[model samples]
Target: MGRNRISGVIPSSLGNLQMLNDIDLSRNALVGSIPTSFANFGYLFSMDLSNNELNGSIPKEILNLPSLSTFFILYNNFLSRPLPQEVRFLEWVGTIDLSGNHLSGNISMSIGMCKSLEKLLKANNMFSGPIPDTLVEVKGLETLDLSSNELSDSIPPEIRNLNAL
Candidate 1:
């Protein structure tokens, strides 16, 4: 269920439903780290856990959801840590929202490998450094939000070549 006032931690048993395709637990009061068992959602295509009380580093295993195409975990409780390099595994993913968290460190250049990626919302975090030149490789990207971070250096000159922006 999504957009409800539901509170408390997500149940790990939800992972047992192999046929489940999407989950939207956004705009809730849910707390605690995401259930690691969610990595078992082989059929899951989308998930939104934004605007919740969830905390802790995202489980890297959850990034392996083979069918996952959209992910949103914005405006959450104190989640922190560098996004895992395995994020490139979301080859089919088109949109991702990880803004307004406590995440720190450099944005992974490998993110440019997500061939289908279009919208990337990573504003309002602690990311620092020049935008990776490799990001220009995401030829289909339409919206990229890196505002409010500590990034420095000149804007990648190649950014002008992204016709999709």
Candidate 2:
């Protein structure tokens, strides 16, 4: 139910829809955390929950779904926390947008494990620390925007190796 101005917490029971492949709850007034039960979306390939008031840390269980290939949780009311190491499990994910939130901590080096990652938009958050060296390993990465974060350190020289950039 995208752009429906839907308010209130997401129902965990939605996860029981085993056949669900895509979910778009963007442009809503949803509150509360993303339900852990969402991990049950075993067939889910894409999800968008942008422009909402959803608060709390992103659930790692949702990130570990093997079929998740695209995700957009931008412009939300979520708070600060490093992305889970399990985020690397989304090897099939090609695009991810986690911008315009309060997320903090280092961008995990394990992000390099996403071999298929092509576009990563993580600007306008509270992320700090040097850009992970492992980012250079994403040979297929074409669009990477880490702007407007609190990140320190210089651009890695190895970034030149990303021919797709």
Best by lDDT: 2
- Residue range 33-122, candidate 2, lDDT tens digits: 888898898899888889888888888888888988866445656745877788788788888888888888999999999888998889
Query: What does each candidate score in C-alpha RMSD?
Result: 1.3, 1.2
TM-score of each: 0.94, 0.95
- Stretches of model 1 off by over 4 angstroms after superposition: 72-75
For residue 92, model 1's alpha carbon misses the true position, in angstroms, by 0.9
TM-score of 1: 0.94
Model 1: which residue pairs collide?
Answer: none
For candidate 1, write residues 58-160 as lDDT tens digits: 7889888889876544555567888888888887788888988888888899888888889998889888877888889899999999999988898999988
The total of clashing pairs for model 1 equals 0
The lDDT per prediction is 0.85, 0.86
Give the Cα error of residue 154 in candidate 1, in Å.
1.8
